[model samples]
Target: LSLTLYALPYTLAERIAGPWSGALAGALGSGGAFFLFFANTTDYIPVLLFSFVGILLGFTLAWWRPVIFYPFIIIWNFLLFRLDERRAPAQTPHLLHRHSAFWDEFQRLPLVGLDTHLLLVMERNRQEAEAAMAYLNTTRQRWAARAAQIEQDARQLMACHSIAAIGEAYHRLSTSEATDSASALLRSFSRISQDVDAAMRQESAYNRRLALSAVEDRLDGLLRELTRSNDRYAARFRPIAAHWREVVADVVQQLAEEAEMRQEIDNPYIIGVPLTEKQEIFVGRSDISSHIEQLLLDRRRPPLLLYGQRRVGKTSLLNNLGRLLPSTIVPLFVDLQGPVSQARDHAGFWYNMARSMIRSAQRQRDLILPPLARDALAADPFTGFDEWLDQVETVLGEHLALLMLDEFEVLDMAFARGRLDADGVLGMLRHVIQHRPRWKVLLAGSHTLDEFQRWASYLINVQVVHISYLREEEARQLIECPVEGFALRYEPEATARVLALTRGHPFLVQLLCAEVVALKNEQPAEERRLARLVDVETAVPRALDHGSFFFADIAQNQVDLTEAEVLRLLARQGEETAVPRQVLVDYFPSLMALENALIRLQKRELIERIGDGYRFQVELIRRWFARQPA
Candidate 1:
């Protein structure tokens, strides 16, 4: 009973530790029971004391592992006289050694390495952990540039006001998306790509306008599908397309209905937007037109250089040249800003010029040539442009052609970039003038005459007409004359305030007038005018939406940070005379630092030189710049 008590405690303690520990406990408990069976009945208390002490000793040795549980068990039986070994001097065999044979049974049991098994399991789990980490690291994000492009495409869709422009825009977007894997929406969008492409591919159709009309229904469905798609890109940009879809559809429908009767109509109060031949609302610039006509009538018909500040009606002047010039002069206007920008070489420049010249002629006058003549002109028209012009001259015998190349500054930059051949293009212009006497060229830019020194030799004989801001009378006509057709009127003081703000600049006058008119329109029809000077004054500050202006062309594209600071300071001055150049230099560390920036701003027409001072050339620009956050 005493040995049983001793073995019970040790067995419970060792079993709680480990499998190996539990085996040692069992050995101890069994050894104690054997000792109890053989122990003397007369000295039970002494025998129980020895059993407890001996079982504890065996358990301590067995726990160390170096003694090993099996070895401890064998030693235990010997010490207790339980084993019948050949060397044992005991008279009878031990009960455990002979009858129990527990050690023999334990040896027959299979061996296992629990520590090694645990390491293998841990290694497998590590592989699963690494895979989970890799899955978490993977991303389905589209790049920022791709999102920007989609936004750009959406804006283009909104701006495409023409029938052909809409079809062309859709086709271009689809073609771009085929190469673009920006998002899953774009990838899935290719399903109807063939339909969009074939519909927009107007060249393949027999009747161009009719083919476009047929595709309108299909295009509407496609746009709806685009709006319904569930994608991050769609979520970002689909709303922009959807918002404008109705407006765009209305415009397309109108253009389609009046395709035959449509004529270019000029809005008298057009601001930032250039006027076109379709518009007849020319408010001023009679003086500039007279000067250009006189220049064209000169013996040589020398190139006329028209230079002005940004948004000062340079494009409007070019657009109205056909109507302004004598019918005999046959004024031809070509906006080479886009083509010249994309021009790669002299050939490309000539090709762009020839194509524009041909297109303008077709649009203005239904000038037609024989198919053979057209074919000859089409083949290498860049080099054979003079020949084509000679052919055109023959077709319209004695017809004087005044080719007006608007936005010539872009062409100038093209030459500087080495994308256009300096000698070849300039020489071509000089040669065309020398050879083709009837073809009169008008070169207009926002830059000063000195900026044109790069092509000085070609323009040596050209007449430079410096465009000035409108006179007060002309500015008044723009503000008050538009009211005649629409039954609107302006207060005398309102006109005076407009003259004060705009400084008779054409674009600013248009913008200020448009703002006042928009506010007046919101009121009752009778109240829709600048009759209330108070109302006009109040709306001036709120009417200027920064998004409506093309400040990006100035802020990001043209000026550097230093030049922008010069503008900001000038803006703060608010209609005051320009700050002195020396004072501006003081703001900078040195004169040399601001010299390039000043020149750049001067070239872009953002700021102008006035005596020893410099100021923003445009009045509204000053107002806009002042509003920008520091």
Candidate 2:
């Protein structure tokens, strides 16, 4: 292709100018011709040879004046093309579109002629083209008018809600001496923000015309205005929102002064109160509760397993259950990390349980477990635990006890000898499950319960509840709750982008929202304005870099492996859409250890599985790795 374009000047010069001009043109054009021959030749020999020839030729021309080179070639080409044209055959010029058999015609005739027949024909075609353009213009105008009318109607419908009232709060800040007044107005607007939102959604849904482009744009605009208004309202009132919360609580207390607070349903669903900015807590475990109730609530001897990947809220679920259970149900929550080093026997489990039970009893203000805690500490931690359990059962007479151990897989005997196959703890759990009538064991870990069952063999009738990723609607609701303060909203594409990036992980979702909130904080007053509570732009790559989150512990872990090899492998495979297992094995010879390392890395969510291999879990990390010097 380069040669074709390169030869054109020489060919034209030879046809019109003369041989001397064609030679000068060809010599001048040799630089481009060199590129064609030198294509893809990066090897040392090829590069060295080309460099030698170029240098030798350039030195040979040291005596010639380089400045006159361009003009001399141009003059020479002018004579060559004139000479070449004379030798060429006479033919009518025409543009042709090649097909297998049939040829295509050009709208503009190529043959030059000065006659009434051709002139009249060309004039008629020009008129037809102008008429088509005029018709298109008329159609466009009609569509524009219809769109404008739809927008007007949609805006009017939007105005019927409190969105405009809330939006007014944002505009109020532009004026001086109205900041406090704006805050007050924003508070007033917050009281009915959701009501206004519900109304807008109803209006948007019922109006079929909103599906049209004009109406849809109008609807979106109004929605955004409302969101910005609410965000402004939040920003204005944030300092006082906590105080407002106390005031609301005081009011609720006053209303229920005569009633029992515990019996009454407190506002668990944060529908009206704006969730505090930067306040993070694990909430909403209805599924976890339901599974617990079905498998362990009424059972006499239940061996229940609650398994999910690390940080999937397995511990949170158990804590929620502990809060909800009655005093009659003795629930002991234990962090199982201690057992691997200290819990060599049943004595360890008992001692660990005693302290855990004391904490729970203290939280509940129950005096029933005080003596048991003290008595258990005096004996071996294991013997003390068994004695305390018996004493508690004797005191409470007929109550049931629920022992919840978190990260229970750490107790595996395999992990004890620097492996993960622990059958001893599983046997102890099985013994408790079979022998105890009023005791139920709830074991939670990052791995599946079947892993424990395989080792124990005696863990019969144990119910396994698998905690999976949240459904789309659940994740959206979770995100929507936190962003209400920002009044930022996400377009559907933006929502999907966040979900895809985080893979609907709860902690990851919170991290993304925090980043967006930080972005909003850094913007200037004019730039800070937004239409939605969780807009995509605030979460886009330009909005934030999540690479730091992925590579956070890289410095810490670099000492464990060859930093260069680990980084190189990750840099290559992590950015890949998918990496083969063999590629990883080849990259890291100690792949068995590397696999374990990768698992630990996955728990941190620095990478995610793509079919058989993995990809960087964060986009910024992928891009960063891609740009690294090889």
Candidate 3:
């Protein structure tokens, strides 16, 4: 009966165990009982047999893995299967991993790319040198003739006082392609030309003509700076000219290797599209939506300021606000890029706003305005718009009208340009909010709260909410959740690398993951189940270059010249630290210019005013800014 009892457990365990596990279980069960049977006859025998068993049991018990493996073998097998699946197929590679050492040496790049960037600079300079050498070898005289033309124009501009002759000289200098660094050198000449043009055009200035004559000394000083200093390129870079081919060859080799590596990845990840809006790929912005929801639920219904850097998921949040907010408030997406952008003045704004509000209210709530009032809004919106808003309020008594003005910077731009009356528009909105407590404005822009108040003065009453980068956990969700459907995963290490590289910037997180997924598709089908370390190393550079296309215009279009120069100066240094106030002051020289540039950069959220100096709020922007060519 005791044997039967022991045999019953062994049979049940074997039924659930795999082939090897079942055999081991059967052996242990039968052998243990047999040994015990003999041991029962002698205390020393039992002690001798159980001594080793006890030791092993004690060790194995602490591990719990081999002992616990019985129930979790399926999970273990799954992991093994995935690991085996990612192993590269046995074949000769197109590029024999030569760049592995290159990557090893430069692995700290992207984080501290300033030194590595010198390689690119040197390579570019050498290529220019080679081209110049080729041109001199091909037609030395024609190049010399153009050089003479540039020199003659430079001399004439310094001494010649005629404005017409100055314009011609500037034009000649602008259109030249002489010398080794002619392309970079002309930028200085161009700025001087612009300064001369502005000075000559100054109608009110008393010393305009004298200021224009200063172009002579300006041209002389600039020529010295360019020819002597070699502005953006190295004048004596020829020492490393022989080693230049290695840098170009390295990138080329990496590209070829990447192409081969990609051939193994199928259906790689794609970017240039948002994730959360797609619903299937939506991820963690609960950090944002949760606060917005609670704010919406509040009875105050005060105006909101949704501020973030460009492309930080502000539009996505706007699209999702209605779904995430409580049912008490109605969110009508007021896209200024929509028909509302055509508003040129206060009257036009009222007309366009009424059209949008009526259309949105009807579609969202199936509530239609009376035909008479709708006609009144379309014809004379300046007066009837207020009445129609009252009717909308009557239709939904307790429900609030949460007006989300996206890209509200458009109005600020229009106000700055004098096309829209800022006081009139701001006053109208303020009056509406004051009378109708449930009617609140939710304004979002690439600018800041101080800017809104500066433009309107009435916006001082509004509440501002700054949207920063996603949290690490949220960023992880963005990286992992979307790829779940493809039965693909970024290996935990690769995921951490992504989080570290992007630093929880949402757009960057999405963009990098998308590049990773696309790069992943190039791998052999069998090897694409998980993103590996090499895959991350390969994808980062490509992703950075690709994503920078979106940011290339930020400095050009967003800030003025002095602001851009300050930003560039900061970027050139790389990394964030407490820079002395004097450093920036020296960069700008003028106190007013320095203060204006810093303020605009702050309002744009490009950098922050922390401590005595400032640092980039988004490290990725700093990385991007650092990579920019001088």
- lDDT, candidate 2, equals 0.48
The TM-score measured for candidate 2 stands at 0.43
Which lDDT tens digits does candidate 3 get at residues 1-630? 333534554466657974335434544555465566557565566545554464344334324433344334334433433443354533222111222212122122121222222222223343432333344334322343344333443444454344444444455554432234644344444545555565445431222333344554555554445355634443322212112223323333454466455543322223443322223344556767777766655676667788887777787777666566666777766777665666655556665666566545554554544322335646555567677677777877788777878888887777788867777677777777667787778888877666556544676456667786788877877777753544557788998888776777777777777677767666777887788877877887777788876677687688788877777777776666545677887766689988888887877777787778787766567777777777
C-alpha RMSD of each candidate structure in angstroms: 27.4, 32.3, 34.6
Model 1 error, position 149 (Å): 34
lDDT-based ranking: 1, 3, 2
Give the winner by lDDT: 1 or 2: 1
Task: Please give, for residues 312-394, the per-residue lDDT of candidate 2 as tens digits.
Answer: 56665666565555556666667666643354445445555565665455334344463443344454544455555677667
Better of 1 and 3 by lDDT: 1
lDDT of every predicted structure (CA atoms): 0.60, 0.48, 0.58
Number of clashing residue pairs, candidate 2? 37
Best by lDDT: 1
